[model samples]
Target: MRTTPAGGVVLVGVLAWISGVLQLFAGVLMLVAGDHPVTGWLHLLVGLATFPVCLAIFRARVWARIVLSVVFLFEIAAVVFALTDLRFLATPAVTSAVLAVFGLVLLYTPSANASFRQATIDRRNRAATAR
Candidate 1:
C-alpha cells in the first residue's frame, strides 16, 4: 500500500533539503574563495550526506531522525557562535542553521511520531509478506 507523508514530515523534509542546498553552495563558495579547505570539504560532505538522510526521514526511518537531530543540534550551536558576530548575520550558514533547527522541531512532533511508528509497522508487514 502506498503511504502519504505527514505534514510535519513534509515540512521537515523541505527544511532539510533547503539546508542541504545551502551547505552545497557554501562549500563551493568557500572552495572558490580560497577559504579553509577542511571546512569547505566538510560542508560539501554534509551537503551530500543530507540528501539521503532526507529521503530516509521522508520514509519515517527512526535512524534518520536521530542522525538529523545530531546534525541540527550541531548546526544550532554553530549558528549560536556565529550570531555573536553582527557581520555574519546575513550568511547562508545562519539561514541553514535556522532551517535545521526548525526541521528538528518538526521531526519530533506528535504527527511525525505517529507517522514514524506507522512506517515501521508497514516495513515489518512488507518484509513478512515478501518472505
Candidate 2:
C-alpha cells in the first residue's frame, strides 16, 4: 500500500473537479437565461454531487473510481447515440466522447488501480488501529 496516489489518479481527480466547476457554472448560466428550469436544476444537483465524487477520487476511493467509470460509460453511450442522427462531427459531442474515453482510460490504468487498492488497504488499517 503506497501513501501517494498515482499521477493518473491525481489528473483524473483534477479533471473531475474541473468538470464539476464547469457544470456549476453552466447551471447558473442556464438559470439566468430564465428558460429550461428542469434542466438547470438537474445540472445544479449533478454539479453539487460531483464535488464529493471528485474529492473521493482524490482520496483514491475505489467506490469513486467505480462511480466515475459508470458515468463515463454513460457519457460515451450518449455521445454514440447522438452520432446515430448522422451529426458525426459535432464539436460538443466529439469533445465529450474524447473526454469520456480519456477519463475511462485514466481510471482503469494499472497505476490508478494500484493506488486505489493501496488506499483501500490503508483505510482498513486505519480503522483497525482506531478500533
Candidate 1 per-residue lDDT over residues 27-72, each given as its tens digit: 6665666335655566677777788888888777889989888877
**What value does the lDDT take at residue 118 in candidate 2?**
89
lDDT of each: 0.75, 0.66
Name the runs in model 1 displaced over 4 angstroms: 77-90
Candidate 2 is scored at a TM of: 0.69
What TM-score, over all chains together, does every model reach? 0.82, 0.69
Error of 1 at 66 (Å): 1.9
- Residue pairs in clash, model 1: none
Q: How far is 30's C-alpha from truth in model 1 (Å)? A: 2.3
RMSD of each: 2.7, 4.5
At residue 14, candidate 1 shows an lDDT of 78
Best candidate per TM-score, number? 1
